[model samples]
Target chain A: MNNSASTSNGSTLHEIVRAEISRRITTGMYKPGDAITSIARLAEEFGVSSITVKRALSDLQSTGLLTSIPGKGIYVKDRFRLVCELDVGMSALGNIRSLGFQPKVQRISVTKERIEDVTLSVFNPPDRLLLCVRKVIYADEVPIVYESSFVPTNMSDKIVDEFGKRFIIDALKRYKVAVKEMSFIIDAAPASQEAQRVFSVPNSYPTLRRLYNLKTSAPTMSIVGIIESPFDRLACSVRPGSGRISKMNKKK
Target chain B: MNNSASTSNGSTLHEIVRAEISRRITTGMYKPGDAITSIARLAEEFGVSSITVKRALSDLQSTGLLTSIPGKGIYVKDRFRLVCELDVGMSALGNIRSLGFQPKVQRISVTKERIEDVTLSVFNPPDRLLLCVRKVIYADEVPIVYESSFVPTNMSDKIVDEFGKRFIIDALKRYKVAVKEMSFIIDAAPASQEAQRVFSVPNSYPTLRRLYNLKTSAPTMSIVGIIESPFDRLACSVRPGSGRISKMNKKK
Candidate 1:
């Protein structure tokens, strides 16, 4: 054993063992669901105290990579993958560049309608007119996000016809309305028939859905609601980076 | 029935049905985990076709409000009442206010360490010194986040002593280091022994672990890695609002 304390760094014996095992796991030497050696055996192998081996195993467990059963030894957890959260401002179109898969948008419809009581209550629009646009977003040609966006009616006449555009943020910018702030509510539920068709999940598959409110300096720009099936399969990452230029700067 | 075509305003039969059901669920008419009537029953109840009822149910399921079993009927999924994403930015400390519960930070240890090959490769510090701070953060006084942060040594001696500060973001800012960007890699694993103590979960509990990289013009901040027990209940809301932010923002 290279017992020479590598530098002045006094890494606990447990940390050293943990790092070695983590390397093996990340490198695919230990495949998913593989059983790690018994903690006692591992302790013997590493010439470390059993308490140290136990601590190392404990670290791996906390990272969601390992599972342990009572009386049974440790096993690797299934479907462990890193999720990266990317920040794309508040515009739906801003997310395109960072999406791991190519997203194709198919506009289902865009129409002007008298504001419903529910929507009116939610957006509290300055005016009673509303424009609703429905679209299906496909990732890798598979539909993953089914979205309906409600905008105030006076915004634009070309809203329905502009479905082929790659990003919605650009279109909103063209309308001279900038998305300044946004919020989201996410939940998991079962897939609807349309969601089943889009996500190719079983009819009974559960999904995660998010409702987003896009706001400018005005009351509200749009209410974008998305229906996603198999919510677990879709990884979400939320990282904050530099904010967009302030609305005042954009106006100038 | 209001057969006026304008009454529904081109909204799909599915949308109307979904809206009605969602209203009921959110209004507390239907409780979580309660089974909604079967498709046939709902169709008969609403005087709509079974296909329309199915579509609405599917929409609810896709939203994570409902779950369905192949052999059985559909039921509501558990609702997570509070979900907030922390952001990495100038206003990152604002995240504490967004959380449904107050966050309490407890510093466990502060130590100086020499950068060895493994530590060097992981942190890639410009200097050879590293400051380590270990802490646990609680939500509603329940320990949920156990973290260790490594800062470049030359930054300041205060980085080590400021361990007891309530907010790491504010502490870093006070030290004259601006956090420009943060990167996070999140995954699931089992809880470590230390995690089990802090999070108070059983050995079998799953955990969400994140490795966060806080950077400035130079990577001046630190790598803050946290292992949190798998939430027994998780809920998310992404909407345009003043008080809430995305979960993607909180890792750092």
Candidate 2:
């Protein structure tokens, strides 16, 4: 979206102007919470009209890189710190809590059913019936995640009642089924009809889908599931300093 | 989309049939590399028509969780494993090499110009001039990433010629300017005109945008940049196992 092509210098004047001021703020020439030079002075110094300089300041403000007080002049906001990456390992309820939102898991249905082929192929399993649980997780009363899981029938009685309240892994761990490893296949798919209904999103909405397996330290780990959310509603990220990044770096 | 709503017993017959067979395969009742029961046998046992059974099998195949041989039989594929998360820290050339594809860096433009606001705010002081490097990174002759970076004018001469051949960090590190840590803000944004043209994608395409900053150990990081790709062309993922997932867990 750069306007570099339109200008003779191959750089937009407004953008360049924005950059100069931003550089000052980042380099501690303009410290955090420091008042910036007036727009007119900056415009005159950069040889651009006040309007052009204002657009640049607005851009910075929108990105949260700068802050504008009601009547006061603009000031440098905090440095661009990392927004924590979304943790896929945390339970839906747990994640909502982490974000400072009250969470609720509304259990929609639970049934003992034969495991489906796609899910079955991913886990160490039993040939018997498995408990299939479907629920909608909400953050601050707004439905956000549609989750469904299939677990061994033997573990059904232990979690059926509070199924919506806790992560299946956390619940399973209570039975000494410690999850040692997990894997995820993440993709964007057209939302399923059930997902559409639960999320109140349009049909064929591009949904971020995560299919994962929970593996225990024991020779077996059979719990597998899917979590789907509208792409716009979720924030997914990763940082180099967290989790098993070192292990992956080592392998590389 | 689920057909559960239209079916009795809280599950579709075909899905149930799929689940039963999948359970068998997952439980070692049908081991990996072992041929599954014939379609006719499965159809009979599940009391579903051949088409239903075929649909179930096809669903499994699409997920890369199962395989079928022509006229031979359906056999279990390996258990679903974690697809490698794209390493955001790796250089464009290094990432392409890891993907087993020859990478080519087609330098689009390099100009010494004033920096833009959001970018300038993230980096250190620049003496009014900055080197803006833009390039399309290709994998197997297909453009997969559009990357652009901004650095202090002082380092422009150091990397201008080989800019396409090396990561800016690596080039800087050669001058003993080491990067100690980096952070990312990953978001989905409407594709810009430049991005749309480069990726041959539509306007407002849900472009995957990664904006990052590299910092030296000294209380500050200077280089700021953006990497963008068409959403469909890439799989951007982060495993919770990597990095300080434990710390994130503690915060929760």
Candidate 3:
């Protein structure tokens, strides 16, 4: 064995073994989807028992770098990347497609209600009625995002017609309503009862909540949406490089 | 209790109650830190039992919109915004400060080890030795982020000196190392045992993992950092409408 794989003193044998394998995966020696050496082979190579090798592999798998298929052998997981940003300009449909998933939109309900005092602030002349659209977005047959959007009453009919019409972005674009600005707040919170029902998770399940306001050039800039995802199944991410500026600075 | 707060027909009484309170908070009727009406008052106003009002408030609290003290009444939570983007040019210290937290750094350990294979691909001329620095970063006495950074052997000394010197960005800047590019992959993963120990979360707890490769203009672009945060406390967000472009598209 090379000096790099040599065990460091004072640490557990299994940790060194795990670290060695982890290094291999992160260093690109074990490419994604590549089968790793068998437990028997690794144990022999590392001069450890099969149990020790198993433990090491299990540790690696827990962190999501390696996956062991039953009956089959272990392989590096496919490198999965999720980037969350406003500038993508892609509709939810496009986003799912890019991730190799067929997205299915299940409209939960549509209701008209009198506007709350705070919600009215998003509108120019703050109207009385609002249309609330609730949807569950599924990717690859798994519900991934639960979205609740509140739009002004005036825009309800057009939006309802475009409900399943591909992406919400496309729907807005069809009406020549360009989303000029958006304000977003992202935080982690316990899943609500409705979220638990939608996601099949227990109460207090950690979930990411993204509250956003989409504004247009028109005087009434009044569309707000709340997107929620169970933290176990999904993540929201952003990469700042590649000519992208920080949106925090752009806040008016 | 005007028409705006009228209950939709189908939802449960508690749900309608929750929605009413949620709307009031979001619409600025109940500003952050403002106490809402008492449970008895709300119960009487909504013509529901006190248990129903309590349930509604509890639901809103679970979603992080409200807070309840032991003796004090329920009040809205402080407005918080965390914008995760690349161009802020602020160090971790600055970031925490911006969020009104007193940041503390707890250096876990630093070790020198032989390099792994896939990690080597991130560097120009992959070196053999690596210096891994692990730190537990706290905000207002709460552990918020666990950061493990791997630096190349040549830069270890200066980088180590920069450790806990405010933020890693500031330390790199002091060495005149300009991070020109960064590639990051964000995903949800079970908290490893070490992560659980570090963050005080349960085993297999959902956590957000951000694995990043940072490249400087210098020939050696060899620092990679993995940052993890408990799913219930911290979130990474991106705002797209600013001049910033999407980093996902810029990948080579």
Best by TM-score: 3
DockQ, model 2, C-alpha based: 0.12
lDDT at position A72, candidate 1 = 83
lDDT of 2 by residue, B1-252 (tens): 232333323266666666666667767888877888888887776667887898677655533335677889988865422223545334646555676767777889888777664533533545477777888877777677787887656654645556655656545544565566666655544455688678654323445566766665432446777777655555455545533323434544
Candidate 2 local lDDT, A85-193, one digit each (tens)? 4554445456667777787878888888876645335444566687888888777776667878877666646565566666665566456565666665554544566
Return the top candidate by lDDT.
Answer: 3
CAPRI quality band, candidate 3:
incorrect
TM-score of chain A of 2: 0.56
Please give the lDDT score at residue B173 for candidate 2. Answer: 48
iRMSD of prediction 1 = 11.4
The residue-level lDDT of candidate 2 at A106 comes to: 82
Clashes of each: 34, 15, 12
Per residue, candidate 1 scores C-alpha lDDT tens digits across B66-131 of: 667767988876554334343322122244346455767788887776544231243354454567
Using lDDT as the measure, name the better of candidate 2 and candidate 3: 3
Q: Which regions of candidate 3 deviate over 4 angstroms? A: A1-86, A113-129, A164-166, A241-252, B1-86, B113-129, B188-190, B204-209, B241-252
Docking verdict class for candidate 1: incorrect
